[model samples]
Target: MTKLAINGGTPVRDTYLPYGQQWIEDDDIEEVVKALKSDYLTTGPKIKEFEEKFGKYVGVKYAVAISNGTAALHGASFAAGIKEGDEVITTPITFAASANCILYQGGKPVFADIDSSTYNIDPKDIEEKISSKTKAIVPVDFTGQPVNIDEINAIAKKYNLIVIEDGAHSLGAEYKGKRIGSLVDMTTFSFHPVKHITTGEGGMITTNNKELYEKLKLFRTHGITRDKEILYNKNESSWYYEQLELGYNYRITDIQCALGISQLNKIDKFLRRRREIAEKYNEYLKDIDGIVLPYQEEYIKSSWHLYVIQLELEKFKVGRREIFEALQAENIGVNVHYIPVYYHPYYQKLGYKKGLCPNAEKLYERIITIPLYPKMTDKDVKDVVEALDKVLKYYKR
Candidate 1:
């Protein structure tokens, strides 16, 4: 049998560190246990507490917790009044949900090129893509760096476009010193195990718009209105309710909310540790030839969700696949942040072709996400750096 490249036995430094993962603590479990023992489990007080605390933490007036990130996107899109035949502009260098939410609401997704350095949707390209059918712009905060929201907002004002920021990787990120949630019409965040915080599987949609908040609240449940004022008859008992609009069963359980509350308490620590890891990577890899480290705009503070490094293809003897395989051989777990959304088969069938977003396609050729999570220790960081050094040296022209 061929020996595995990275020694899988004899405590060989466990080489499968992934690009991102949850950092659960004992306290997180304790909180969940407390909730499990409490009176309510699904639609309980803990869920409301989580929503209020999370909304306040992000400086938003309203937050609606949902089943998962995809549901959050769907809720935001629906609340934004995205109707059939409408067009939503967004970048291709993101998870498909960023675009699929548009399709879910019977809206078309228009691909826009991304900024080469930040890997964010380019505001200029977004402006260029606008047409009569365009109703909104969903700018993804890719890899935890907030997009140029000010510029995007300015463009939106010019075109009367609603802004829905896909903030899956940017729960703790800031733009121009302001929290990301408050800067757009609607912002969606994920709580997957790999994200900065985890509530098993959960998501939140934040916005300051009262109408949007009410709409999202109704949409999160089964479109049933429990607000007594919205009822036509005051004599009706608690059993009486109204289905104001078609909605979904995206309500989050109290058990998850309990965990989220616990996780939120440690978010600052999580963000700090992630930044430390990212800074260390930047310091160690800055001098390596042909490697393009992530760039943070002066006005933005990233949550450092993933430390992605781009390779200069012309300077290397081997391609991205070769380097990735070599790292895996060395027991270093690596990943790509995304494949351009348009490259997916479903989108291709929808008339999205390869050349639509050249910059994003170019980014796809060289981007590699290295391991960077809050749980990673100093030695782990050193190990990752050493592995990269070895791989790059081995593949150098």
Candidate 2:
């Protein structure tokens, strides 16, 4: 019997399972409470504490705490000397902010096509997109899988371009035995509720460059400096500060940093559970025909922020939307990771047209993100698999 949830058969799960979620424990709550009752909420000791811990974890010499991921990208872009009339090359298969940060600094964002197999920015396509206007490359670690850093770095060096890795989906991910944050000139991370860790809302920028580190700190604080060394005018007053340059108030609070610190403590456990879930999904879904799974290279270790499955649309009676809805009907909270940045209305207003990156456009059509979070129980994983199985059985031609 071909059981079909959409055809009124029993659904696999009674309660909904979200595609991603944060794991909050009593420790997390207590940490937040401690920060709340402390003397400072913003610009407190917790901020530096969190930054130092995260920097150490990523094996980087410096890490800057920012208000959110987008701001982290913005600060990195600003520090990279991205300016008017310059062009930044980045993948189309990413959050709009990955490219938008370039626009924020009055630089143009040039689209680069992705590798068909990895769904990450292709180095060949990146090199092809380079022109005289190109000043930097922002390669996104899509779906927590690390892009080929060595190839990207080589290209960047050949052209004397800065490399800013968008590691939003790849905090704990490793490439060739090293972590994601330290390989590029700058790497950005997010701590959204659904990310590997949660500070409710927060982000980080990690780097080994001392000058970039100093600039990032200044940028996060309205370009002001209280340090006697960096300040232009010598002011002996402890309260005296100077605005060094135009910068935004992109600062993270102590409350969030406390929560982040708590979450960071359990990152290993969270990563292990996420990998376990991904492995199970691989085992269960491997036999499902007309579906293409996420590809992980043997040289890298993915944090598995998202487990996206691509449908072989030609072999399916139902399309991606239909499969998405069918799974939703069975109480699986499936979602799409992104629409190609240039396909959005704002980008269109900026005169970006379709076919900018054919592979990314095609990927946007076929990919569906399913439930793959640490909070999911064994039953939850099974339910998601069973629901997907039912949908595929009914829809596969």
Whole-model lDDT, model 2: 0.93
TM-score result, candidate 1 = 0.96
- Which portions of model 1 show Cα errors greater than 4 Å? 1-12, 232-234
**Residue range 254-368, candidate 1, lDDT tens digits:** 9999999999999999999999999999999988888999998999999988889999989899899988877877767889978999999998898888999999999999999
- Would you list the clashing residue pairs of candidate 1? none
If candidate 1 were superposed on the true structure by all CA atoms, what would the RMSD be? 2.4
Model 2, position 224: C-alpha lDDT score: 94
TM-score on alpha carbons, each prediction: 0.96, 0.98
The CA lDDT of each predicted structure is: 0.91, 0.93
| Whole-structure CA lDDT of model 1 | 0.91
